[model samples]
Structures are given as C-alpha cells and as structure tokens.
Target: MARPSMDTDTRPTRLYSALRNIKWEYLVAGISGGVVSTLVLHPLDLVKIRFQVNEGYGVTNRPKYNGIVHALRSIARSDGFVGLYQGVTPNIWGAGMSWGLYFFFYNSIKTKLNEGDSKRNLGPGYHIMAATGAGFTTLVLTNPIWVTKTRLCLQYDKPAVSTSSVHYKGMLDALFKIYKFEGIRGLYKGFVPGVFGISHGALQFMAYEEMKTLYNTYRNQPIDTRLGSAEYVVFAALSKMFAATTTYPYQVLRSRIQDQHRDYGNIRDIVRQIFKYEGIRGLYKGLGIYLWHVTPNICIVFLLYEYITNWKSNRPDNHS
Candidate 1:
C-alpha cells in the first residue's frame, strides 16, 4: 500500500553531498574581489564597450570619443557624472556571480582531478582542464547578464532614428524587454562569440596557476605557500596581458553582435563586414582601453582571492 520513499530520501543526501564538496572560501573571495574591482574600474569598461561597437560610423546617438580623456570628458559633458556608470548594475552582478561560480567550479574540478591528494602537483594540463570547464560553465550561465550589460552600456540619452533602436531603464527592464521582443535568442545574442571567449579565461587561469607553481618550486616552498600582494599583482598582470592580447578579438565580435543599433546575420557576416570596412584592426577596437581596464582588474581579483583564501586557511578554527 506504500510506495518506496527511497528517491525522496536520496535527494537530500545528494544535495548535502554537493554542498559539502563546495569550498565556500573560494566562492566568497571571488565574489568580493570581482565586485570591488568592477566598482573601481567600470568607467573604463563602459568606454571600451562604446568603442567596440562603434564601427567608424554614428552607430548610436552617443558622443564620439577621440581618445580616453576625450571619451571621459564627452560622456561626463553629455550625461553628467552619472553617465560613466551606465551599466554598472548588471556589470557588478555579472562579475560577482561569474567569478564566484568560476572559482567554485574550478577548485571543484581540480579537487576531483587531484583525487583527494591536495599535495599533488596537477601541473598545467590539469590547470587548463579545470579552467576551461569552469569558463564554459560560467559563460553559459552568465551570457544573458553580459548581453544585458552590453546593451545598457551602449544605450544613449538620445534615441537613434532606427526602429530597431531600443532602450532599457535598468537591468531588469532590459532582460524582460529583450525576452519579450526577441525571445531567448535575444538574451543570448553574443553567446557564440562568448563561447570562443572562454579561451581568455582558461588561458589566464592556466598561466596564473603555472606561475604560482613555478615560483613556489623555485623558492623550495609548498605549492600552496602564500605570497605577498605585490607578487600576486605581478603574476596576475603578466598572465592577464598574455591572455587579453591573444583573445581580444572575440570581445569585439561579441559586442558588435550584441549591439542593439546594428544587426548582423551571423558571426561570419559580422567578421566579413568588420574586415571589409575596418580591416584586421577592426577586430581589436578598444584593445588599449581593454588592457587598461583588465590589468588592474585581474591584479585586484587575484590578489584578493589569494589573500582571502590564505586568511581562511590560517584561521585557528579552520585548523581542525
């Protein structure tokens, strides 16, 4: 007369197992670092997005920016001091959630690969594997948020004449309108290019981890040995520079695909138009601003991540 409740009982056990496996310290540190860095550096990001979508024409009603200083001055002039932070709401949420999930997944994958041996050096291959998995997971989950951010950053006070020209009051409004008008595909507009951009994170993390491993080995210290903030900054900067320069074109492509003012048939169409009109350099629009934006962003993220993790590990209660 009674059906087995085994499935119900096992569900909670499985949930508990998953929760137990997560390293909460990594998640907290990652969210904190990402939110803080984005808060301090969002203007550069806004400028970068504007430049990325501008294809040498008046694509939107936004003011033209001749250079970094000019762009800042022009935005402030047109939209006032608050103009600089157009898409910061979605940007902060995206950054925090993305980084937190990335670190959580990355460490989980690495732990699985290590097979409970924390002292084992998994090397660069394992690092790459973990980072790639984490990047893919994070990208898919957060692509919609990024699409919303791009659109919001690209929004102007004055609307363009195109019927396709749209505006968002805020992050929630953008998501709802995009979904209502364009369906799920609209919310994931840049997802294809974002998939390629996964390499950016994978390469950055792999390089960062490798440098830390090598430094510890050279110092004859444990692989987990904590380093000073200055050391973390140097390593993060180098790794980010390498990754950013190598993988920047995808960012331009993603921004262009996500641009509300212009529409392209496909990635190939976008690439062909960009190449035909702007040449190879078209693919690297805003790279200088990107470099300026990301260098310090990575430094702060990695430094805080390391510091937070170290602090957690050193806590007396954490010693068992």
Candidate 2:
C-alpha cells in the first residue's frame, strides 16, 4: 500500500484543532476581573460569609450580628479594620483561579458545542450546559481554597480564643492544618451543596447570554457584537440577581456545612436544624448582604471581561 499523502498525514487531529482554537483572552480578562473585584469588595464578602454561618444557636464565643451595618461595625471594632479582610488572600486566589478557569472552559465548551464557531448563536440550553461544565470544573479546583477562606474569615481576633475555634495564620497554613487534622474530606465539607450551587452560575450565564443576544438582535447587530459598558452592567446585574435569588439557600447550606464552629451530621441534618430552629427564612439568612456583595461584583467582572476582549479583538497585531 502507498504511504498516505503528506496533506493527510500532516492534518491536525480534532483535539489539536480544538486546543489551538482556544481563545486565551477570555481567561486573562476573567482573572483580571476576579482579582480586581475581590480586592475591592472582599470586606462585603467576609460579612456575607459571617452572616450565612451565624445560626443564632446562642454561640457565646462568636460575635452576633443584628444586620449588615451592625456586622460591619462590630467586626471593625472587635478585629480592627484589617479584620474585615480576613480571607482576602484565599478569596483573591480562589476568585482569580475560578473566574479564569470558568471563562476558559465555558467558552471552550461553547465553541465545541457550536462546532468550532464560537460566534454561532447557542440556545439557552446550550449556554446552561457550557456554564454548568465550567462551574463544576472551577468548583472542583477551587473548593479547597474556599474552605480555607471560610475558616480564615470565621477566625475572630478576640482576646480569649475559644478552645474549639481553629486559628490559621494564613491561607497556606489553614490548608495544611485542615488537611493534617481532617484530611481531604475536611477540604470538601460542603461539596454536595457546592455541586448544587453550580446551578447559580449556570443560570446566571444562561440569562446573561440570552439577554445579550436579544439586545443585539433588537439593535440589528450580530449576536456576538461588542456591547457598551452600561449594557454590560445592566445585563450582568439582572442575570446575577436572577441566579442569586433562586439559589441563595444553597449558599447558606454550604457556609453552614463549612463553618468550623458547628458540625452537623450532613447537609440534610443542617437543613433540618435550620428549618426547625429558624424556619424558611433561615435558609435565606444572608441574602440581602449577599446581593449587596455580589451584584456589584458581577457587574465589574462582566465589564472588565467585555472591555478587555474588545480591546484584544481590535488590536492591530491581532488583526494581522
């Protein structure tokens, strides 16, 4: 038999083609947006986590929060101004890694689903699938970081530390300590609720993409047309609110499961305790604070992503 033609032998495999078509700009923009947003709003994030884990079980050691204002002032007065940013290190790392990987994987999967043409319009179902895949991947990679961040934030800077309370000097120390003490299971304490939380991202992205597509269609532009900052802000905020409102309960569950102060048997046990003691409102404990923290966060991330991608696409060298 004759040897295969040079063209046939040199043809790139499907995997190679897909890998080569991967647009790295999305990852860069996402990492940049995530780091910047976290730096700006980490205090609110700390407050949100604190609120979520506070179940009013009469834990004398931890500080009590009446509301967002009280929580901010109380944390500041007790732990000083620096205390508000207790989990900044791990939060930044987790946010940056998560957003970067999420956008990369989401766009990559979307491209694959569209048969290598990323500009092709995908339905809401396809968008959800892409976002879900990205969210799951990002969660697996960053769950340990989030667990460390939660523990770090929950460490109060009081004069008398509770015997049950675990103090971590920093992110690495916390990770090491958790693994040393509780093993891999400790790092993934809230993994089940976290899996459910993927719906948050999936819904947000699906709504976001649909809104953008509709807006562009209304304007008689291509589906993938670049949008203005205001447009991005509106779409991002709306989509984030939609997702956060629907999935806020799972967040409370995740925080409670990961909380160092309380150890429930499992997710169901936690749910039962919250329901029995706190009722339906307990499941949405920190929703107000969460909205305050996350709405601006999504806006910033989307704005940065859009602007950065637009600039990259318009670059002279990129055109060449």
Candidate 3:
C-alpha cells in the first residue's frame, strides 16, 4: 500500500503532459459533435434563455414568450426562421471550444490521476476532482465565448435602426461592439456565475465516469472499454440530467446577469433583485426547457465523443 501510494514515476508533470495530450482528434470530435447538436437543438436553447431572462413573468408586451410553442411562433414571426438560430455562430464557437477543451483537459487529467497498477480504478471522489479541474480550466479560458453566445442568443427583439446597438450580427461583431461600448469587462458579464456553474460539469463528468466504471465492472470488461453506442448514450444522458437538474439555478442567475437588456452591478444584486421580484421559483425558471434541451444534446455529444475516441484509441500507432 505504501509503495503504491508513494509511486512517483507514474505521476505526470502538469504542463508538459497537458500540452502533449492536446490532440487534433479531440478537437475534431468535440467540434463536430457540438456543431451538429447545436444545429438541431438551438431553438430549445433559445427558449430556455428567453425563459430565464424574462422577468416580466407573463405581463402583457413583456412576457417575451407565453410558452414553448408561443415562443417558437414569436421568434419566427418577429425574426423569421433565422431567429431560431439567433446566436448560432458564437454558440458553435462556444460549444466547439468548450467540449474540445473539456475532453482534452479531462482525459489528460484522468490519465495523470488514474492509479498506476493493473487493477487501476477511480471512485466518484477522484472523478469529481478530475472533472472539477477540467471544468475550471475550460471555463476560465472560454468565458468570453460563452458571454458572447448568451448575448447573441437573447437578442431577439430587433431594433428598427440597422446600426442599432441592440443587434449583434455575428460573433466577431459582438466581440468588437462589446469591447467598444462596455469595454473588456463587458465580455465577462456572467463570468462569476459561469465559474460557479463549474459544478455542473464536475458533477456531470463524475457521474458519467463512475457510471461507466460500474457498468464495465458488471460486464467484466476493462473500464469504459468496448461499450456499445446505446450504453454510452444512456450513461451520458443519465449524468447530464443529474447535473442539470441539481445545478440549474445558477444558470438562471448567470443568464440574468448576461442579459443585454438588463444591467446588474454584481451577483448579490442580481440574486437579491430576483428574490424580491421573482421569488424562489424564479431561480428555476427554464429548468423544464433546459432538461428537454440538454438531455438529447449531451447524449448526442458523448455518443459522438465515444465513437471518435474509440476510433483513435484503436489506431495502429496507439496500440500497446
């Protein structure tokens, strides 16, 4: 036990290992899966964003959208079909960067942390730690991308003026305008809550990794080895649902902070204002829509990721 605990050679140096594991395949798999899923599921993501920031709570001319169908109809009638994909550019960028960086850091960290023995295994706690590290690193690097995405997604109400400050034509446009008007800090609007939301990914990966480990044990196979697509989808869906359900409220708060129509000085102010006006229920405004949106999204992403990683691992040069 002492010998195993003291094993130093298996422990990786942090920076070099991370840099070395930055494979192009990870980027390809993550970007491809994210872009595909966002294309299919962006409408739901838009609805959830509208729901979160719609503090009017069903008031006339203020309700944004009465319900899902109503929201869909409203977006179509107001902004046309493209409205459904309002901030899709930044969303693609964000989603692609997010998952790409996440998988890269996650696998690198997992490989480093995994037990250096024949019967290598990791429990839930280790999984959580690895995911937490990965999540934090990804969030810090990609917060600006996410901030641009949120603003673009919520820019549904078009102004009559072509040069209106309200509209963001594209991702690069949003970045330039945000820097000009709100300065560098504007691009980081919801960064605090976004950081807090790291728990969501941490919890998701922990549950996902643990579930796969348990499944492999039951099947008497190497951990996460030779799993079928259905199994991967099931594990991905279960973990995503769990994480989203448990850590959703922070998303609402983050959305509110990032809403271009509203301005908040701080997270405490946002929370207090929401509590005063919207009450406890306000915290979970779009959970239903989010669940509907995130469930399939995660499943599709992991299904793609699993297959992609499997292919890479089975390549001739990668074999032991």
Scored by Cα lDDT, where does model 2 land?
Answer: 0.90
Candidate ranking (TM-score, best to worst): 2, 1, 3
Superposed model 3: Cα runs more than 4 Å off: 1-23, 57-63, 115-119, 161-166, 312-320
For model 1, residues 1-320, the per-residue Cα lDDT tens digits are 99769998799899999888778988998899999999999999999999998897546455678999899898888888899999999999999999989998898899999996777899888888999899999998999999899989988765554344466889999999999999999989989998898889889988998998899999999987888888899999999999999999999999999988887999999999988999999999999999999999988898888888788666999888
Q: Ten-residue segment with the worst summed lDDT in candidate 1?
A: 157-166
lDDT of each: 0.90, 0.90, 0.82
Better of 1 and 3 by lDDT: 1
Candidate 2 wrong stretches, greater than 4 Å: 1-19, 158-160, 316-320
Q: What TM-score does model 2 achieve against the real structure?
A: 0.92
**Per-residue accuracy of model 2 over 211-304 as CA lDDT, tens digit each:** 9999988999999888888999999999999999999999999888888888789998989999899999999988999999999999999998
TM-score of 3: 0.87
Q: After superposition, how far is residue 236 of candidate 2 from its true place, in Å?
A: 0.2
Superior by lDDT: candidate 2 or candidate 3: 2
